[model samples]
Target: MKAKNGSMVAYDGEMAFKKLSGGGEGIRGMVTRRITGEQMTVMEVKGHGTCWFADRASEINLVGLQGDKLYVESSNFLAADAGLRTGTSFTGARGASQGNGLFTTTVEGHGQVAIMSDGPAVVLRVSAQYPLTVDPGAYVAHQGNLRQSFQSGVTFRTLLGEGGGEAFQIRFEGDGLVYVQPSERNTIAGDV
Candidate 1:
């Protein structure tokens, strides 16, 4: 399995941890990640009976992917099955607004992935009739076939500090599950 570097705290049986310079995506992926500023320090853990992983005592959520794609931020990523393919993808202005860079992490294949959040994550379902809007800072990860769009309610009123607290949000349509944390991170678009 691949986990965030230094996130392994305890394990039973035998385990070997090796630091991966660039998320174990190979030389080309390393260069691409470096140039895009979507860096992730990862480690490979093998021969583990029971491995415990944590990051700053953050809450963790388990997601099972059956040939689907999961889009998550590197900062919120904890671990994934070794068979899962990890890469980076463009997130456009959503990442810029959250101060998380222009690229997010992608995990695909039939395996389980672990994600972290400031608080317990709430899973919300989105469908053709039930689209959901999420605060960028509260979003953790999402899976299934979903279309994400960045929405900004910033207007002239925002200039005068009278904007809505949630002026920036990510709208999710199609069919999928969205993971959201109750707490919001300090983001550039938090107040407007």
Candidate 2:
């Protein structure tokens, strides 16, 4: 119920647990409930959770996943959970609509899991005013309640360093918190 000295204390149905890893590093939370028969769960965190993030523009970080329906950029990516069926697909690459890497394990609702990144993380509350445009590579973890999609149709001007739109972007539009790493150039499982 309470965590001090950079630790996480979690309670699940009269069962309490603490996170051995300290906070201020990345997404820190606990599993609250498990979905009936899926490879996903509901996670809850104290304070705002974040991923390895940096504004440097060229830094990279390794990362890993622990849930289904994960959205990640092709570049700056290293590896994923061991249980995941590895595959690569571009923004509009053929068969991308299949949604392969998104979900890995089979968990149900109310279940909890952990997502890890290289360093510290930044939690953002997405909304219309400050709509979050996450670089696919920088995405780490998000709530199961959020919606994920792909956005395309960009003009040449946008690709000429215009900043409005470029090649393509994996879009997450909904009312849920997202974890992003500052280092958007690192692969999750690439050689460090």
Candidate 3:
């Protein structure tokens, strides 16, 4: 299993933690991760029987994937089953380098992934019948087949802080589940 460093709380059997590159791609990956502003600090848990993990006091959410890819921010990522594969991909203009990661960590294959959020995450379903739009700040992760498009509501009024408009929104079209947290602050989303 691969988990965020310092997330291990307890274990019942023999386990050893080995630090790994952001996506286990080694030193070059670290350089790329730094240049692209990805936060994927993690450790590998080997020979484990039972293990407990946590992101301090943050809430933990489990997502089950069956031969599907999960798009998630490294900040919210907690852990993943060893059978899963991890990688990074560029998410274009979701946040635009405003402190939110423009690249997200992806987990692929059949397994369960652990994610951390500010509070109990809310799950929203998006399908052909009904598409969903989300504020980037509250966005956490999305699973299944979905199309995301960047939409901007910024206007002259936005600069004056007097317009009834949102600066930006990510529209999800297709079938999928989106995980979001309750927040008043603006955040960013990864690529679909």
Candidate 4:
């Protein structure tokens, strides 16, 4: 119904909810876990919605959920709902085997979902003039206002200091929002 200061609210029926809780004053969403079955904790992020886990996900089942408009960094997002398709860009991490990267897909209808690893997220405003550049691992979801493409100019090989282009990046242009996490994913020994 209402949020604290420094927070923006966007509601789309019960399918979408957004809480910009950070900066200046401080606004945290109300969260409550409501599941007592067998397995992990199923936290209902009040207006934040819910996240579904896939069998391949490591640590937690699913990550964060988005109602209205939300941003998620790479490490924070274990996996997102299959609703959005994978973008053509990817990047490899130090200890990563298959190259941990970012993906993008348009949310059908009038809503979308985002999963996160840690707590509340930070929302950044992106426009044509001031685009956003994020680490390959901290992105979660974005509004359908931007375009995803490989970085131009410097070749991947030159950027990675390798022989060829092994690392990849997503170039976001136009206008939209990006979600990022403060933490990177902790690699498990046998995660691959």
Candidate 5:
């Protein structure tokens, strides 16, 4: 499995950790990530049995993917099966609103991934009839065939400091599940 560097807490069996420079994406991926500013450091863990991984005691959620892609922020990603492919992709305005820059991490293929959040994560289903809108700071990860668009409620009132607390959000349509943390992060749009 590939896990975030320095996230391993313990293991009951024999294990080896090898630092995967450039997020295990090789030279080309390294260059791409560096240029996009979505850099992530990963380590390959092998011969593991009951391996434990954690980040600052954050809550962890396990997601299973069956040949589908998972979109997650680099900060929330914990680990994934080695068979899965991991990379970076552009996130447009949603990323900017969260203060996470313009790119986010992606995991694909048939495998399980572990994601971390500040608090327990709520899995919200988004169907054709029931779309879901999420605060950028509260978003953790999403899976399935989902289309995400940035939504803003800012108006003239916002300029006068009377805006709703949630002025920026990411709306998900199509069909998928979105993971949202109970707590929101400190973001550029936190007060908007």
Candidate 6:
């Protein structure tokens, strides 16, 4: 398994951890998903029976992919099965806010991916008829066939401090599961 460096808390049985590589790409090519060049620390855990990984006591959730792709923020990605392919994809638009990311980590293949959130994350179902709109800060990840689009409700009032916190929303339609953390990520727009 490929996991974040320093994320190993405890493990039972024989295990070996090696610094996979440097320069952003992890052992399985897992990227931090930052085009601005932030180093991603990753390590390969081999011969492990039960390995525990955690980051700041955050809640961990497992997402299963069967020949599908999971789009997740680099901050939420914890670890993934060895066979899963990890990479980065360009997120089309910026939310008129500074904190929403422009690139997201992409995991493909048939395996389970562990994601972490500051709190528990809820899985919402998006169907052809029932679309879902999510605050970008609260979004964790999404999987399956889905169309993602951004809706910015920025107005002059927003600039003058009379607008709601939900000035930006990410709409998702089609068939898929969307992960939303109970708490919002720290974003510049949150103050607005």
Among these predictions, the greatest TM-score belongs to 5
C-alpha lDDT (0 to 100) for residue 153 of candidate 3: 72
Compared with the true structure, what per-residue lDDT tens digits does model 6 show for residues 1-192?
878888999999999998766423543343343343333567888994899999999999999999999987767889988888777766666333426456666789998999998789999999999999988888888998999898888899899989887887889999999999998767766666
Alpha-carbon local distance difference test for all models: 0.93, 0.38, 0.82, 0.36, 0.94, 0.80
What TM-score would every model get versus the actual structure? 0.97, 0.38, 0.89, 0.38, 0.98, 0.89
Which whole-number lDDT from 0 to 100 does residue 138 have in model 2?
A: 55
The sequence of per-residue lDDT tens digits that candidate 2 reaches over residues 2-57 is 11222223323343323423121123221211111111211223343332222223
TM-score of 1: 0.97
Candidate 2 regions exceeding 4 Å error are 1-112, 127-131, 158-166, 186-192
Q: Report lDDT (Cα) of residue 88, candidate 1.
A: 94
Q: Give candidate 4 misplaced runs (Cα > 4 Å).
A: 1-106, 111-114, 152-168, 186-192
Candidate with better lDDT, 4 vs 6: 6
TM-score result, candidate 2: 0.38
Model 1 C-alpha lDDT per residue in residues 1-192, reported as the tens digit of each score? 999999999999999999988899999889989998989999999994999998899999999999999999999999999999999999888898888998999999999999999889999999999999999999888888999999999999999999987899999999999999999988998867
Which predicted model would earn the best lDDT? 5
lDDT of 5 by residue, 129-191 (tens): 999999998999998899999999999999999999889989999999999999989998898
Off by over 4 Å in 6: 22-39, 94-100
| lDDT for 97 (candidate 5) | 94
Better of 1 and 6 by TM-score: 1
Off by over 4 Å in 3: 26-31, 185-192
